[model samples]
Target: MTRRYVIVGNGPAGVAAAEAIRRHDTAGEIRIVGGEDTGFYSRPGLAYLLTGAIPEESLFSRPASDHDLAGIHRTVGTVREIDPQRHRIVLFDGQAMSYDRLLLAVGARAVRPAVPGIDLDGVVTLDNLDDARRILRLARRAKRACVVGGGITAIELAEGLAANGVETHYLMRGDRYWGSVLDPYESALVEGRLAEEGIRIHRGVELAGVIGRKGRVAAVETRDGSTLACDILAVAIGTQPRLELAHLAGLQTGRGIWADATFQTTDRDIFAAGDAAEVLDPETGKRGIDSLWSAALDHGRAAGEQMCGVGRPYRRPAPFNVTRIGGVTTTLIGAVGTGARDVDLVTLGRGDSNAWREHADAFAVVSDGEANHLRLVLGPDRLVGAVVMGDQALSRPLQHLIRERVDIRWARDRLSRGPIEVRKALQALIERTVPLGAA
Candidate 1:
């Protein structure tokens, strides 16, 4: 029998799964149903689009013709419901489709706070390409903009808006930026860079409510009874997985749809992947949720193989992401937090996985007294995690050391001596231990 495959949410995970399935089962009937108007585009590049760093055409990852060439059928509509027992899905427009296997890669959406006038015309989020376009349109007329959040998305918005000539005011609920991930010195470095770019940083402020005039954002009221003049109010408060469909279809879920090591969900025939899959971590005995693009791509491919009866147990790699934060190219690998916790900071990051916070241990910080910064999380016998900011000469090496858990027991004492000694030791260790073939 020709296997009929139906995948939901045509983003990176869904699209990657379709291609992977096509590679293995040449005759499988693969249909990708998505709600977005456009095809797959680089979600991370949306920041570049806002800042005019890259042309709009550069945002797309897979060309539309690639899917057609691969014999993958694409449909656009909102999925009204999924019937697992019936092996079918119904779209919002009343169209129904059945499949032998179903993959849910619905991804996630940015959360909007429950503030008065939040639904105003000038209030927005940069969740999708459409949201980025809307933000650009608003930036044209926006004189002053206020953004609240403590992660990468919030920084991207503030930077993009400032680049667009809008006087941007970034509101931090805590003392600094990204407190959950970046330490005090790291946060200060990012704050200093953003300040140089003309972004006003307001610390220890929370959005009490948004004030709208004529059905558009005119100002925002802080918790301290201060009203700031604002034409645009952008919110990048964490993201939540689209789990309503999974819940309604009788699938068990916690932070996301629960999935086994093979990416198989509670139901054998249906699978979950990407940001929506709360995959089990056998090592930690906890379910892991990821909002990273690379995680989605890797999981989607492995999930496709599982659907094809390959039974490839998805091997979740150590989390790694390289991004420009506050105008500094930063690379984060594994876990780098120095046991610092911030409830105000959103636990989930837009470009990071919540799993990075799973292992927090002893760490050391090194800097060049400028924008360049490096921090290493140490384990008893190996390197656990790292954060490389500014100069990234050590980024890939750090990732390899942490990911492979290379032994550093010989140099643990020397590492704690000081910054200069630690740098020399890590440079020599990376050169000696890491082979060129290391992934």
Candidate 2:
């Protein structure tokens, strides 16, 4: 009997799941439903598109011919509801598709906060390719652009606006940039770099409302009674999982739609993945979405395998994200921000290593005078979390140590000595764990 597998998205996760299903169940019916008409494209590449690093037409993850070759059926419609009892999903257009197994990988939607004049013509979000095109059009005559929010997306938007020769103002509700992930020291380093790039930083200010002139955004009004002139307003606060269909399906949900390690939902036949799925950590019993591109791809593959009767749990290392913003390479590994107050933080400051800077510049161009800071989150006796800024050489080793739960007790004294000796200490610890020949 040919089993039917229905994937309710066309993003990285959903596409990966479909391909995996085809690989395992060669004769099974595989269908991918996407609300967007376009095929899969790189969401991360949207930022580069703003700076002309990539052409608008080059965002697709794969060629148009590939989906047909894979024997996957693609549909354009939103999954409005999941009727698990009937083993079918109802589309927004009232079309119902039945499946032996269903995967919900609908991803997330970008948010625009409710404020006066927010519906004005000049205010837009760069969530999808369409939004990117809209922003590109607006950027042509935009002189002063104000980006609201303190997340990575907001920072990237601000950088893109500045790169396009527009005067950029990064308005954050908090006093520090990325305060959730960065400490005072780390935040200062980022703040200084942004200032050097002529991107004005306004912190601890609440966005009271947006002011418009003749149906177009003219200025941004703050709660403190100050209004900053702006030709465009871009908001990149954060993202919430698209879980309306999951809720309608009567699936248990928390941060996102709850699924077990195998991506199995409340109904054994229904699975979930991508930004929409809050997978439970088998070890800790915690349910949350990793929301990373790599994580989503892996989850889809694992879920696909499980659906094919190859039982294996989807296990992932602690979450990490690396990005170069404002000419500074920043890497956040593990639960760096969530439990910072509980762990022992080791701060190492390396003030302008000319040699190190040159080495790193080859990979990613950073600010000329930006200082490097490496901080490790040590829990009990093992390396757990790390924040690498300016210099990313330590990012890989730190990630490995955290993932492997390697003990760094032998380098405790050397680590406390500060920046100069910290690298040596890490090298020593690595050499000890690894054989001499391997080192």
Candidate 3:
């Protein structure tokens, strides 16, 4: 009998799930439903698009028709609700699709502050490719622009706006940038780099409300009792998962739709993944959500295999990412602590779980300098987390140690000895655990 598999949300997770299912069961009927017509393009690439590092057409990783070659059928529509009992989902147009098994990889939406004039024409959030195009159009007429929030996206917004020859102003509520994730030194490094690019920084300030003229953004008022000329206000605060369908389906949800290690939700036949899923972290034994492309791709594959009746449990990989911060390349590994909630930077600073800040209470050792910086978070007997900036010599080794729970307790006592021993010790451990050609 040919089993029918229906996957919701057309992002990386949904697409990966369809491909994975095809690989496992050739006869299975796989259908992917998404609201976006662009099919699958790189969400992370949207940042580079803003900076003009990549052409708009270059944002596509593969042609939309590529999925048809793999025998995956595409349906474009917004799902209104899911009825697990009937094994069917209703589309917004009142169309319905039934399935033997369903995967909800719905993803998330960018958040903006709730204030007056938010509905004005000039305010936007850099969430999707459409938003990116909208910003590019607005930048041409923008005399001055302001970016609010912290973390990588906020910085990218400031840089992208400044690159268009518009005067860019960055507003942060904290004294330093990304206070929760980056230390004072790391914050200073990023903050200083932004200043050199002609981007003005406003620390310890908040957006009280926006003032509009003719129903478009004209100026903004800060909580500090000051007004600034701002034609465009880009918000990159954070994101919230879309869970209306999950709720309608009667699935258990919290930070996101709750799913087990196999990506199975409360309803056995229904699964969730991507940014929309609050999944179990194989390492920490805690469930959390992620808004990253790599994580979503891996998540879809695992859930697809499970839907195909793969008996093995999916071991979520460590949060590994090599990203650009203010033109500097950096790599992030497992469980580095989180900062205060005000930073609103949920994208990269944390790990597989949002509770990364709980581990922040632990002590850390640092290898500090002008450009290169490394901080290792040590638990009682192993490497819990690490933050690598500028240089990446220690990144791969530290990732292995933290991900595998290798005992680096011996190095804990040698904290005062310096980074030389730290690097040597990590290399030794990687040699023992990783194979010759690996690491």
Give a tens-digit lDDT track for model 1, residues 1-439.
9999999988888888898999999999999998898988999999999999998889887899999998999999988988988999999999999999999999888888888988999988888988999999999988999998867899999999999999999988888788778878888889999999999999889999999889999999999999999999998888888998898789999988999988999999999999889998767677888888888988889899889998567767778888899999998888776555654455475897775676565666565547688888787788877888888878887888887788889878877677878888887787788887652
Better of 2 and 3 by TM-score: 3
lDDT of 2: 0.76
Q: Weakest 10 consecutive residues, lDDT, candidate 2?
A: 344-353
Pairs that clash in candidate 3: 180-339
TM-score of 2: 0.89
- TM-score of every model? 0.97, 0.89, 0.94
Candidate topping lDDT: 1
Rank the candidate models, highest TM-score first: 1, 3, 2
Better of 1 and 2 by TM-score: 1
The C-alpha local distance difference test score for the whole of candidate 3 amounts to 0.81
Question: Each candidate: what lDDT?
Answer: 0.86, 0.76, 0.81
- The alpha-carbon root-mean-square deviation between model 2 and the true structure, to one decimal in Å, is 7.0
Error of 2 at 275 (Å): 1.2
Best by TM-score: 1
Ranking by lDDT: 1, 3, 2
